[model samples]
Target: MPHDIHIVTEAELRDIVTLDLALVDVIERAFAALSEGGVVMPPVLSMDLPQANGEVDVKTAFIPGVESFAIKVSPGFFDNPKIGLPSLNGLMILFSAKTGLVEAVFLDNGYLTDLRTAAAGAVAARQLAPAQVETAGVIGAGVQARLQIEAAHLVRPFSRVLVHARDAEKARACAADLGQRLGVEAEAVADPAALVAKSQLVVTTTPAREPVLMADWLHPGLHITAMGSDQEGKCEIEPAALSRADVYVCDRGSQCAERGELRAALAAGLWDRGTPPELGDVILGRATGRQSESDVTICDLTGTGVQDTAIAAHVRARFPGAGTVIRA
Candidate 1:
């Protein structure tokens, strides 16, 4: 007898899965499982193509007690948009943990990645941000920028949002869209410093190879989620800014030290090994989150395989036995 396999299309996924608190909780559980040593996640495999301005990353993980595990391939070609295509696309392959059989394939085209990434930001805010958040800011006007703010609103009731982008028009458009979706007073700002100064919670979602947000702009009680620097040589926040953080957290210390904002800090001799606690540790009660209302914090997210696995399992549960079956 042959087994059945499921194939989830991008449209099918978008119709069902949303960037809401439920998804946030799913990703949160993955982090907790990771911190508890209940997951087997290996280092990410990444390839860079500077000539083409593109990169690809492969990540996977096995969580104890989960029925399935997922392997994800994510590709980012910066030049794709110039040819009228999206810069990001990818898919996830789910396998049965019990027998190693193919279970399903989520052809999400990077939507799952975006959703999990944004959820991680919200999880960071829920655990690390100050109790009261009136104003928020985003450092990039991309898709993730808007999603990050939407996810943040689930954890905190921000009344206003400030967005900054290299392109003034894009920034204004993003601000308007966010304002309508979140029902908040979202506006575009020309200065990154002004956005940072006015926001209690800030999210950076750019792909800059250099620091865009400086340390001098950081204020007391501000929590910054830097999700931009997921690759080597890519930095969105200043190394000095990380040094000023009272609590610096990362999704994974090993990944961060090699490819996240912490990497830049370590290279400059500003940070030492084991300096930044993994976000999982905080969630598992092994470490503290916000020690004081005025404490400054930063969460460096480089993306993890555990997130892919968790989301895959969640989606499979939603649409059980709905795809075509294949004979092996």
Candidate 2:
């Protein structure tokens, strides 16, 4: 007999969970599973709707350790701002790898996306960030940027947070929100350069098509997470910035090279697909991160399918009794 399908909502998983802690948890288990060599997650197939400026992505991941399989459908409406809607939306489905049975569904499209992306940041910090990174800086005062600050706080107990945005008032507001939430003072910087100067760890989570953080602003003993610009023609950090870093890492360097920050670096001849370690390799202990305190490290995250699978499983366990399940 065939069992019915289950659906879960974003509101049920969590409310205002900080990006750092949840992100770290997702990365730890995901990488550990990857290290064991039984997980296989190919690149996701995605398309964008021009008229709506929305994105639709499909991803599948296989994890043998948990005997689980998952697929996700997510969309992002960049024009949602003008439409007075949110910029992201999506859902996740977890299945039984053993019998190929669908098990749980997560209905929050953008929420899971943000959680996994932030978790990637925490994962990067655990392996690549400097030993004494007490200050954190975030560019783009959007929701993702706010979570970045919180996630880093979980990995490292930072004393100060610096935030920069296209709008001064928005940046200040974001900073104020973080300060109030974390009980740590967040300073709103006038520009990216100022935030980059004082903070050893920087996270960029904007939707800019051009570069936001410049190369000259970076210094040694610094680690950066570029979370925005996951698609083609989208870039947040300049190519020169990657060139300045001694180590460069990403969830998938090939995809990132084709679309994300890696694309810009390859174009400027600063680096290419042949360079840097995949974040999975580093987490698996197959590659080294931060050879010394003076070296610069960069983690460019374009997201992967495995993340969607893991988060779907997490959310499903919590919301099993709440969602509707009906046989098709």
Candidate 3:
């Protein structure tokens, strides 16, 4: 038997998949499937290259009824900017669930990953952020920081945005870009605490090994989405902040405990709350979300393979079917 493998370029994928509400819904359904159980997702395979200031991660998931599944390979080199290259890049391979045959190769150059990750932040905001968010703050000036704010605005429209980063120049530039792009007030806040003080929603997108957002900065009606600590040894929020939140959620409790923010919290003996609710459960109404306007909620997103598969399948379905196809 022979099968056709479609080779999709980054341009083709970019044309099909944009970070919009529709893509967010696709990610949302992925989470719903995760909570309903029976989804076979393997633990992430991660490797750190200390000498190169880089890391690589491979992730995949098999949904019971989905026609295809995806395996994604992603690499991040923090010093890529020095060489005029992006810090992150990757591709995804989709295989037929029924036949275990190659279906497509998505050479997205990490664009899909970026979109899905940002959409996950939006999902967290939709379920956890306050009903009316007048001010939104993000603690990072990288690509994720910009996308996260845009994605969140799609769910909870904010009148202003505050940007904070360790680099003052980057923060100012990111703030200006966001303000012009979002058509809203945006400024760079020198202090993380000040940004949190005036924000109803705050997202941490830095790849910091130390805590960037502290427990003391948490205020009422605040929903924090920490998305940078997907790897071990990465900590964006203070360990104690997990315990301090009125309701702390994880994208996946088990994964979070091993590699996400929950890992740090557990090591510090701060996550004694025992089995925190996952984002999927909250989305499905199986658990609680922001109960009151004054509630402080936090969601720890470590990224998931299901998102990769979901987004890949979506692009395939929407594909023009004119890519380079190789039969195997």
Candidate 4:
């Protein structure tokens, strides 16, 4: 028998899904399921096109008892902005867990990815950040940078935000925009070290192959979430910083060792691949996180397949019947 496959456009999704505590809760539960040990998530399949300054990653997961799963294809072309195009875009194919049949196609064009990634940052902050955060700092002036600040605010309620980037103009623009939109005191900082010195919460959102954050800048009561280093050869934080952290966590230890900030740390002999606790483990009480308010914490997020599946399932539950549907 043929079944109907719904096609939900990005506009439709934008109208319904948003970055809120509710969405963060959904992603949080997904991470819990991941740590609880029944979800089957595979390693990310990635392809790099150095000539075009681009990369693509395919990720998916199957959590037992979830009605649907999602396979997401995400492409990042760093040079696209030169042509007035966004650097990241992709879609998700939702399938039935029982029959392995296509149920819907989400033409989110990277919105869902941005949402889930930012939500994960919030989870990290909520779990490890100090009791009070007056200022937040973000390294990078891109989409993720802005969203990360917003996400961190949801959990920590910081009153000020600092933006740092290689491009000073873009950094100022991002800061100004965020200040107006978030109704907070936002400014562009020329020095990442200065930003880190003042902020209780910091998020690294760049795709730099070199370190943008150094180890010595870390201070007590600070929590850093490095979400940019999600690919091989990409790094944002100094390797020694991981060793300096009082509590070091990652979305997945193995994945981080392969593609995130931990990869560089592992190569430098500063960390043991199996030593770091995963974010889900801390959330599930399987591991400790931030034993003291003054502890310096770091969270390496390489993005996760279970997050895609969880967000996709959430969308499927609320998908309006207005999208185009075709029988397959």
- Tens-place lDDT per residue, model 1, 13-95, is 89888998888999999999999996889899889889989989999999998899999999989999899999899999999
Candidate 4, residue 149: the lDDT equals: 91
Residue 127 in candidate 4, Cα distance off native in Å:
0.7
Q: Indicate which candidate wins on lDDT.
A: 3
Cα-based lDDT for every prediction: 0.92, 0.80, 0.93, 0.92
Q: In order, how many clashes per candidate? A: 0, 3, 0, 0
Candidate 4 lDDT score relative to the true structure: 0.92
Candidate 3 lDDT, 112-214, residue by residue in tens:
8999999999999999999999999999999999999999999998999999999999999999999999999999999999999999999999989999999
Q: Please report how far candidate 1 places residue 89 from its true position, in Å.
A: 0.9
Worst 10 residues of 4 by lDDT: 315-324
Tell me, what's the RMSD of every candidate? 1.5, 2.2, 1.4, 1.5
The digit string of per-residue lDDT tens for model 4 on 1-328 reads 8999999989988898888998899899999999998899988998988998998999999988789999999998999999999988999999999999999999999999999999999999999999799999999999999999999899899889999999999999999988998899999999999999999999999989999999999999999999999888999999999988999999998899999999999999988535789999999999999988899999999999999998889888866463689898
The number of residue pairs in model 4 that clash at the backbone is: 0
Distance from true location, Cα of 247 in model 4, Å? 0.4
**Model 3 steric clash pairs:** none
lDDT of 2 by residue, 7-126 (tens): 656776555333546556766788667656778877778887889878888878887766567787878788888978777777777888788888877677568778777888888887
Could you tell me every candidate's TM-score relative to the true structure? Answer: 0.96, 0.92, 0.96, 0.96
What value does the lDDT take at residue 171 in candidate 2?
96
